[model samples]
Target chain A: MDVDTDVTSGGGTARPWPIVDINPEALAALESYKKRDPSKVVVRFKAVGNAPIMKQNFYKITASNRFQAVIQFLRKELGWKAGDPLVPHTPPRFASPQLVLNKPQFTYINLAFSPAPDDTVSNLFKSFCTDGHLIVNYSTTAAWG
Target chain B: MSQYGTTRGPPQAAKDRTTDYHTALFRRLSWEGTVPLEIRVDPNELPANSDRGLACYFVQAPRVSYLPLLMPEIRRFLMDVVFDEAASKSLKEEDWWFEIDDGTLLKWHWPIGLIYDNHTILTTIRPGPSLATTSTTPLRLILHLASPPTDKLLLAANAEACKQAFMGQLKEADFIRWGNTKRMTGLRKADQDGLWEGIKEHNFEEYWRVASKVTPTTTANRPQSPGPPPSSVSMHGRPPSADTSAPPERDGAYNVRSVPVRLYLPDGPVIQDLVPPLLEDGSPHTLAHFLNTHAPLLFPPQPPAPPPSRTNPNPRPPSHQELAYPLVQGILAPLDSEMAWLGACLAGADGWVNVCVGISRK
Candidate 1:
């Protein structure tokens, strides 16, 4: 279950599953990236993939809501308008509020994504697992700061 | 007569009563002046060099040694109790067992015996007696400060001094707290007369930490290289800070109290780099120096190979090339010009037959 959102979406893609449930903190973290490059976003989406994806019940990225549709969904979820802070001062680092898992061994996992990075920025971040590989539709990086 | 109780004044009456009660108490605990401390090595108490000395100060200079992991006040108390000129049997063998009431023990010091079966406890040597000669010992604990100490202080740097100081501290407090004296008292005794009233509670916590470091004189610290590669893959070698809780030992288990202590070691050309080599078999710095001096030497310069002369040629090949033409094929291998010397050798360049043994000498 998404920690931030109680809303549920169908397990697989309904074409770029609208970002109606994006986390507020995650939304706040992406403002600057949106302003800099609005067209193509190197975004991340997590679907219940404990099992593998098969073509029998196919899923793909993009629907009536294009990939950019997540941007507005994030804005409304986090209560933001354009010109909001690019990065929140404090990012949520924990998966749960209380450390319920105090075993001898306890660690955490997280989700992160970026808007389409320029060639220079793209080379620096090497993804390890799970890919939506950003589909860049907008290229206004010339004016990005 | 006594309720008017006898005619002795309260002050006189109090002194007389105390005198009668303590006449036999701590009979063995007397020192002309001050007493020296008890020092325990990791597992055993150190041999005492003097007959009537008190306080166990580290012999190594503060800059070159460790900061005393044992609290200084407890160390002083231990020396005062165990290093007494007369307390040889202050805390009789095993247990003399005293019952302490709760009141009127404004200040008192008694002998304590630690549970030697599961504990590392010992006493100081009187003169000719050595630590190896005794069966009692104590674990030495020193307070770890976040920042460094300002003035010169004894950090348990030397094995000999550290052991003695630790023993002395425990011995002193044993009488007043952990000793049988407190164990034998009635539970309802005045909260004030319990012998433990004289002990500094903060001081006891320090003793607990010290006692914890004494892990039954383990010989397990010897340095060893990584064993034959593990049967399964391991997630080691990753830099720390990535996971602060990662265990320090290769096997992921180590003594809780005895951790990776970062005490300053002696300075030397061989061990100058600040790497903490374990003091396992012997003096760690000394062992490092010896290894630096005697480890295996690397490939020696083949006497400059005397630059083989162009005029000299070899006698014969152990086997002729499968191909009829030997010279142009360059000894039957795909080696480039840079290895002409090898080609010359296989052409029996040095009068010896060359053969590729499939590179499987082992």
Candidate 2:
């Protein structure tokens, strides 16, 4: 269950809890929300309840400059290699666009904007979680990692 | 083998084969164009039939192979125009397959098969079609049978001699210079014909390995670029994540597991590279971690379990007709009333089949 909270893209606000399962439709809306304020990256968040979740936290990467970090994260933290498909992912969304500490179900996160937009589907990226909602890493602008 | 009549059409010469090959129910889909399929960026990641982006230039389908039988006119045209320009000066300039693409900048040494038993000249030119579209298109190529001629020399001991000759040719062969063609070629297997014959099939790496076999590796190494600092490489069970450099979360939870995979009945050498590659220290690549990233796409839904029912009907009585032996009767008589005893003797039908019997003196 998604709840949309209208938060301005500023440094003050903490990110919302992210949704694990992301739908293309939600990506469109989140993309629109992000476009609402171009200066700052727009992130989506929600709290989750007792749903069986594989233990892992997911993050949406931005900032092409920090692409090296993202690569290191995959290779070092996640451990990927060349010739591998990109990770599978479920960019998240909320039923209501409002702020709430508690969500009915557990959530995963998507960047609203994917760094790798190739149409090829792979088992590479997966939905994960973080303490906060709307996972946004301003560290890098998206480019070939 | 029969000699080809200079008239050139396959006509009666290939009739029997046409019927046999076409009769096959499932026509094996073959990439008829020229360029290799699955061009790999990293040659090391080859051997298995998987890739990241795409290395298959697929830039364009090369010049038509000019099948002598399929399109005799085109073959004649090209022969007069390209292979034998001096002979056909009267042919129309437009009829010649001129620079539909660009001209070969220069010739280079390329390793070829029996096709170039004679020295072959090649050039570097982008195939014409690629300039417009990158997508692969369907085309057909047929291998003509080299019929035997009556005038050829006959030697009873030519078998081994012929083999040696072929091997001798390979021993002296050079490189397979890329000519002016391109196309994506998926792994393909062949039929009774040797075009893709005992050579296995169109496995990109299989082709590479086969090539590696023919092209001996020497002590000579390619000039090294004191290349950029090497990135520490890792392995993965699945495709690697696109963004690897992201900062690690101070507090995050996840699980990774490894399961033994079995290729129970591989039809061919397709699974040669199924095993994920290992790193220097013998650890998997980073991509392995991301393998479990997607649930639905990667792992399909499991099948439903069978229904549960607990009941045992009486066993069918054994046919006790002509049991002349008491031992047979002793074995058969307890048929119905001895289930409990049989249960003790048996493993209870849970699919275990074994028993232990010991005789003791009282």
Candidate 3:
């Protein structure tokens, strides 16, 4: 495979740091320079399938915050509890009404895969942002494979 | 062997057999690995009259297993000693969370070994003469039964929620490696269930039977069935190869589209990058290449060469300086080890190479 040759070719050239060392204070300062003020990044939410759309699709979030903040924000906006079912429905006569919780809503980046809740917003925006905005896709059902 | 009908030449067949053996060995070792743990309940959460002797529970935890899986047994052993009857009755499985001695919240979704590797990076720092005691000491964790840190950790509500999260990670890894999640989502329901069942039951054969289907193989002898084009926008351009549908390989060197790598930096942040398996010229990407690209400041591009072999026959002396060490599967992986092989063999149950980088104090 000549893998050794390939390893050495990309070995020596040290590129300038694209992503700064993960210092919370330094990261916040660096992000502030990229945006207007207060270290916020623009996040655009898009509804998938029959999911309800938000009145304000674009929200400013702290760039250093983890992605879990976005999920919590969307859940609050949709009036859905953390573990609540995506669609509420009436109970059957034969079964307990409280036990019929449908699938929960899911969030994705680029409609490809679910980013971990711990993933930092700045990292996601740097890697997958489109048109200078981090596009977050939320769906009530399994929208994409 | 007979199924190939001599399509595979003798030497290639031998190489394939060797690779398969090593992969199986690695998986087996990973599955069987265990970490000695000294688990104790947070003293503040314990009842006033709790028995001090029974507060701590020691056990060897399976490295690949989730913390939630051991909750019932651990709670049973220490519940009476820690929580009063009323508190015990009110506590639920999701109410419990674990923390290291330093109070760092442990992510339930991460494998136990990965959690240990991430937190124990300081133990691996070379040239530190005083780290011997800490390195050999059993990992001490505090179990909290109240006020789980919801913001810092995802709520592992129940076993089902934990399984779903694991599946979500697997799909993420598959998508990162193939630029799509079709292979993971396309698995038959039974096979998909089997993958989780295997992990829950710790059955190596059952897990690999389905995992092998999703993981790309080095051999390019599979059928040329071009699946549907990727529906979502590809972050990286597709490799210049005609058979885009085929399981990842442009040649022997460039096998997988991208290696799903999550680097746990010593400081705190976890860096997940879309690292291709090979460099531009199709050479295997090594651990050094990955670190140089991602955390260049910690791991300089051209590390100081080891003192000349003739002068200092022992390349690794007592005072040798190592800027950083990348630990994969709880072992110090050589810098020259190829990412392709590590991703294939040492990836966590979620199918991502989780490298814990330990920066030296010096």
Most accurate candidate by lDDT: 3
Top candidate by TM-score: 3
CAPRI classification of candidate 1: incorrect
Regions of candidate 2 where Cα sits further than 4 Å from its true position: A1-145, B1-77, B80-299, B307-362
Scored against the true structure, residue B332 in model 2 reaches a CA lDDT of 17
lDDT of 3 by residue, B1-362 (tens): 22321212223442352344455677778778877788998888775667766789988877777887777788888665665677667777678788987778888777888877876774443222212224555788998877788777785645676777788788877766766788888889899999889888878889888888887554433221233232112336653453465443332323456778888765466776667666654455788899888776666667354786777876653443345678888887888877876777778888888898765432
How good is model 2 by TM-score?
0.16
For candidate 3, give the lDDT of residue B28: 76
Over B1-362, each residue of candidate 2 has an lDDT whose tens digit, in order, gives: 33322211222331222212211111111112233211112233222332323322222222111111112444343343333344334333222111102221111111111011111101101112211122232221121112212111111112232222222222211110010001001112221122222222333333333232222111111111232111212222222441133322111000011111111010100000112212234332222222222111221233444454355244343432221110010121221211111111211111011111001101
Candidate 3, residue A93: Cα displacement in angstroms equals 37
Q: Rank the candidates by lDDT, best first.
A: 3, 1, 2
Candidate DockQ scores, in order? 0.01, 0.02, 0.12
Local distance difference test, per candidate?
0.22, 0.21, 0.67
lDDT by residue (A1-145, candidate 1, tens digit) is: 4463322322333333233322333233223222332233243322121211111221232322332244333323223321234656634322331321221110001111222111121221111112434322111121110
Ranking by DockQ: 3, 2, 1
Give the per-residue Cα lDDT of candidate 3 at B30.
76
Scored against the true structure, residue B72 in model 3 reaches a CA lDDT of 74
lDDT minimum window of 10 residues, candidate 3 chain B? B1-10
Could you tell which candidate, 1 or 2, scores higher by lDDT? 1
